[model samples]
Target: MKPVSLYNDIASTSYPGRGIVIGKSADGSKAVIAYFIMGRSENSRNRVFAETEDGIKTQAFDPSKLVDPSLIIYSPVRVLGNKTIVTNGDQTDTVYDLMNEGQTFEQSLTTREFEPDGPNYTPRISGIVECENGNMNYAMSILKSADGNPDCCERYTFTYDKPINGLGRFIHTYMSDGNPLPSFEGEPTLVEIGNDDIDTFAEKIWNSLNEDNKVSLFVRYIDIASNKAESRIINKNK
Candidate 1:
């Protein structure tokens, strides 16, 4: 395999849209997971991340300013036992519900597709980090339109059974900023997870995102041996 370029700094790109990063921490003692959202429109920008009973949810920063909640508002993270589920859209509930009924991640996503926002048809990106028997593994998926054709939906899932220490993979909703935004292609990009401190790591990522476009960010570190978790959240609006 060709050496995957390490995305050490996320600010290098102007807009990565929604993104997820999963990997093991530098000390190799915990599994690190991060999810962030960015937007270009007023409706998309008027949002914040709020902690929920099991995970985190996106809420309107100013309810009166929320134009459409159809696609912008939803739970982004949920914890079901040792599985921590995260996604860019409502599929977070789908994966949670299906898993409760004894279904695999891939099986749950089979029923969903890309977003309906064309000409962008924004891809739905999802991820789950499974900590079992003191070992950590993760899976990432992207559902997008086939060749920009709304009629056909394309789905791809990548599983990482042996997460490398200090390394992570990043997948985002858009390849970059554009008129009719392009969907992220190929496998998730490899990234470096430098700090063992969740707060430091989360701040670094938040600082790296494009200031004007970044909306909210969430990061969690789960101790593999004890299954204990620590998390940090940052909302640009707040």
Candidate 2:
């Protein structure tokens, strides 16, 4: 699909739920990965992205207000050797752990389907960036229900072996807000990555999100040649 403006795609929707973007930076020197979460409920909004030994995890911004940790509390990003894994749920660990044991990204996700959250059955959206030997490639996956039917799950995987400069793939848990939120459809949206540095990119994404619903955002850029990474995290709670 033709690349679209990242800002507009996000700004037009009040709630895209959780999103992940992966691509090659404008200058083709780094691999870019961004993940953000938005929520309408107090329990869902009470969150912050905390840095972990390898990547980042979600934590209750106000522990007392957190009603359930089952779906919200888990690492959203993890690093395993030359691959960086990002997802909207605990499946981050599933991909990391299984890949660590010699499983391919697609193979690792076979063990998982969509989230068990009823009506919506929120899709398990995920992406992985692999930088090795001065080269970078990434892939995105979505485990969702057949339309809104939970009895059948649909899984799709999209790979970008030669990502275009200044372009990224955007995938999220929901298509838009609803009583039973709609799961994202079709392939991930192709969007412009531009040439902004980590901070600028993160700032743009955070600002584009609906002010009242945005929770936390994480953006990271990895040097394709050196494997060095620079990251920025923005938490609405603070």
Candidate 3:
């Protein structure tokens, strides 16, 4: 099936948060993809994705003023080999351990509760990386529901791209341009790693974030070259 584009999917909603992206870069060596989840509640305020030791981590910053730090911050998930990691907040570790035990995604996800937003606190978003013919096809979905809660049951496949080099670029444009969402204090950069060396890819993303964001980052790697994979979650704060 042809992958869906984030641009066309989110064009209808005027929500202040939420950025979607899907595309390839000029070199075509790596996929330039990304997506941002925003919220009207405290947790969704002034947040940014930072690179961590495990993977890309998320943190709540004070673009202008941080009313409360305890309520709206979270850890990051790392990307490793042949594994797709997805969760609401800090389920990275839980998901990783489960996968280690040969647990399915659905089984792992069922162990947690939706993020703590009364109305829209629990939107189940998942990211998957699949290996096919010496390449990885990536897809992520954020279950959008009218009721403001996580019902992985309902979803909108905003991004679906395979063997394309637009992963980061597509996400950059989608967040930076289309349906532009407010950014954190810094000019948060959307990054692309790997497509060359899995170790390098993992390292760059891991060392890219601040200590806070680095606290919890999930890692998944798809070794198309070997047709194998590995996934893990690092909870630095704990």
Instruction: Name the best candidate (by TM-score).
Output: 2
TM-score of each: 0.96, 0.99, 0.50
lDDT of 1 by residue, 76-136 (tens): 9999999999999999999999999999999999999999998999999999999988789
Put down candidate 2 lDDT per residue, 119-203, tens digits, no spaces: 8899999999999988899999999999989999899999999788899999998888898999999999999999999999999
Cα-based lDDT at residue 117, candidate 3: 45
- Pairs clashing in candidate 2? none
Off by over 4 Å in 1: 1-9
Count the clashes in each prediction: 0, 0, 37
Query: Candidate 3 at residue 6, lDDT?
Result: 33
Ranking by lDDT: 2, 1, 3
Instruction: Give lDDT tens digits, candidate 3, residues 71-148.
Output: 344443544455545434465666677767887554665565444544434444545454555555655444333444
- Comparison by TM-score, 1 against 2, better one: 2
lDDT for residue 37 in candidate 2, whole number 0-100: 96
Judge candidate 2 against the unseen true structure and give its global Cα lDDT, from 0 to 1: 0.94
**Model 1 steric clash pairs:** none
